[model samples]
Target chain A: MGKLYVIGIGPGSIENMTLRAKEAIEKSDIIVGYTKYVDLIKTLAKGKEIFSTGMKGEEERCKEALRLSKDNIVSIISTGDAGIYGMAGLILELKDGEDVEVIPGITASSAAASVLGAPIMHDNCNISLSDLMTPYELIKKRIEMAAEGDFVISLYNPKSKGRPHYLRESLETIKKYRAGNTPVAVVKHALRDGQDVKLFNLDSFDDSQVDMMCIVIIGNSQSYIKQGEFITPRGYKL
Target chain B: MGKLYVIGIGPGSIENMTLRAKEAIEKSDIIVGYTKYVDLIKTLAKGKEIFSTGMKGEEERCKEALRLSKDNIVSIISTGDAGIYGMAGLILELKDGEDVEVIPGITASSAAASVLGAPIMHDNCNISLSDLMTPYELIKKRIEMAAEGDFVISLYNPKSKGRPHYLRESLETIKKYRAGNTPVAVVKHALRDGQDVKLFNLDSFDDSQVDMMCIVIIGNSQSYIKQGEFITPRGYKL
Candidate 1:
């Protein structure tokens, strides 16, 4: 007979949190998130108990959050809009007669795309390059399909510490359908103070420059870079 | 050598405005937007000269804002994310050696999608239904293709005084590829104070209930209505 709130905190900024999300977090008796996120909002955890865990501890995090929610108000935070590539799915898998609510936040991909000048204007698609659980072949297939479909591909999990070459591999797979001169945008730490954005041509971008916190948007054939802006036309003839 | 800021203020709240957007608006010498949006943030326009217009006056609004930027800091406001079906395109058409900076905000479709519990999770697409200038037949063809591809369709400008039955017509067209029981969600004044959300089966929704301020999301075959929440899978394996 308890309530659970699943909230997307919008990138890494506290100001990005919605009024409703702030109220939910304030009302919650316990807060659960990754150790980094919990540490990020230390000031908000004034008197509330904090449950923190390391990476890949998602399943355990959900179980503990749900168990504690039986008698207390609990909130689980996701970095971006919760539903897209966030904790919403995992929490749904663990739902057991609990009162749950999802408060959406500004998603990083869209935010990044916005700052980069409408890279996802129309006929765009997003594909993640992690391949942590999904096979590399499937990711390659999706990349091919996205390229053929002329989607402005938003690449999430582009690169990580141990898996540094994933972006290069994915780029290679996309080369068949996409021209090397296509425009690509890299947004790092979007909306979190030290935000950095760079525009690169597919043929010249150094794969070594990418990091996990970045979201890369690769433009389609028709996409153009005009005066440093990345634009993918929506096929509208206005 | 003046600067022009095209800021997307996100859904419909002051809090939804990014810190960067607030800074731009505060530092701006002139603010330009549609009347309703201008009314939304009159406080931000305290001493600045405000230029407001009606729908279909986008070109004029942008031109005036752009003209002012040649000598003063100017900003054009787009309600949702400016790049997605907003002023980014129009601004691009009018760019003339002016330093144009795009400050992205949250889009209404994503906000509505979040409220409806992820109707656009994994492999979904969004298309606007407003054909104010485009022919109805073209919009109809897009709807057919969307339905055939099983993409979650987000209909904007679905209904208004002169186009009251457009949504009804589009629904009938979608029936060719979708079943009568496909889930549909209507979100009015999304993220605003007086937000109203309604759930309906595709075949059972009342056409007269829709209006311009609403966004209708039609789910794909995998979409389901559970406890008044629309759930769409993003292909995350359990």
Candidate 2:
């Protein structure tokens, strides 16, 4: 039986890829991923057989990868951490008997936190606004609870052209529980080319600034902005 | 003015450290961190001035690193991601006017998730059980809310010799809202030399297996264990 490796490439930057992840890709005979992710590592896929799928084709992609893993080493790639909104779960669920290993990578939340000061230094919650797999009501409830608990919150897939109001609605729900002065950060393409980081207060945050690629971080009650950096204290008594 | 880079070395493995993190450490004239983390990267700190402190000495270490940054390029290292339960916040809080940059690394949650299968493939909450800085009441509240929200939960600093019952207490609180058969995974020293991964159900989980170095992940309602792997579904049609 052949082994399969689900690798998180870490925010589309070759520099961010862990040595283990890069080595797995190098050792694999077949490379499988969404087309965009495949393009991100195209230089490394030079001699490997590539199976690239489009968005919304995760199920088919996992099935294909598992089938290919029956007799050949396969490397399936995800942009950020494979276990976080990535293909690890789907592949595990679809695999019949193939040996699989998941190599973790730097997730966008941590990557964005690095870019925009330390906004997640304390307890935090990560929620994806994409209703494709989760219900909107459940997402709203999670957001409200996160706000009430005063947890630093990271929102993924916050907005797209089709679901433009989700980010605004989620922010409104958070505003109902959190103060309007709460510091907010929007980081796009973190650690990659054309990276952008923006800071705003909950009251002044603009929905137009976010998209599917951006990570939106809303600070907890104790979070503050200093010297243009957003930071949440780790509850340490200074 | 000198520059200070707070780098997360990613679970104490040279292979897990990002290229950027390694570059930052290599470019530094002084390296500062907790003694254990400093030891993990000791080979890289060969000719550089290394300043390390024991546990509970974070304040002094950060202050010393900041002081060194006045005339030297200093790299203050942390295990896992520096933005999560790491030294980035403390350094940012203590910075008066030094040029500081936080380079992200793979966090323990992602590393543990990778080892224990995809338990955090959806919305999740990370709460630290250590009450050294946070109030126990707040920690309990976060655990309760995370349970009620059915969010995949990662417990950091779950237990130590000084605080043995915190993990048990936190699990009990989760039991109040979650099913007893909920999948739970404990990963210790993830990606390190003595790595260990354990899987259990909520009712069968043993607290003695955890320590300060362990990360405990509690799966949501839809999570299940198959073939010794703990996985949470991404709410897909499959």
Candidate 1 — which pairs collide? Answer: none
Q: Candidate 1 chain A, which ten residues in sequence have the lowest lDDT sum?
A: A142-151
TM-score of chain B of 1: 0.95
Task: For candidate 1, write residues B1-238 as lDDT tens digits.
Answer: 7888988887768765666677788999999999999877778878899999998888889888888889999989988778777787667656778888887767777778767776765544455666665467756766665666565777877788877777888888788878899998999988777888999988888866788899998887767876677877555455
lDDT of 2 by residue, B176-219 (tens): 98999999888999989999988889999997878889999999
CA RMSD of each candidate after superposition: 4.0, 1.3
What are the models' TM-scores?
0.82, 0.97
Best model per TM-score: 2
Clash pairs detected, candidate 2: none
TM-score, model 1 to reference: 0.82
Runs in model 2 deviating more than 4 A are none
Interface RMSD (Å) of model 2? 0.8
Local error of candidate 1 at residue A46 (angstroms)? 5.2
**Ten contiguous residues with the weakest lDDT in model 2 chain A:** A141-150
For model 2 chain B, give the 10-residue run with minimal summed lDDT. Answer: B160-169
Evaluate every candidate with DockQ and list the scores: 0.27, 0.85
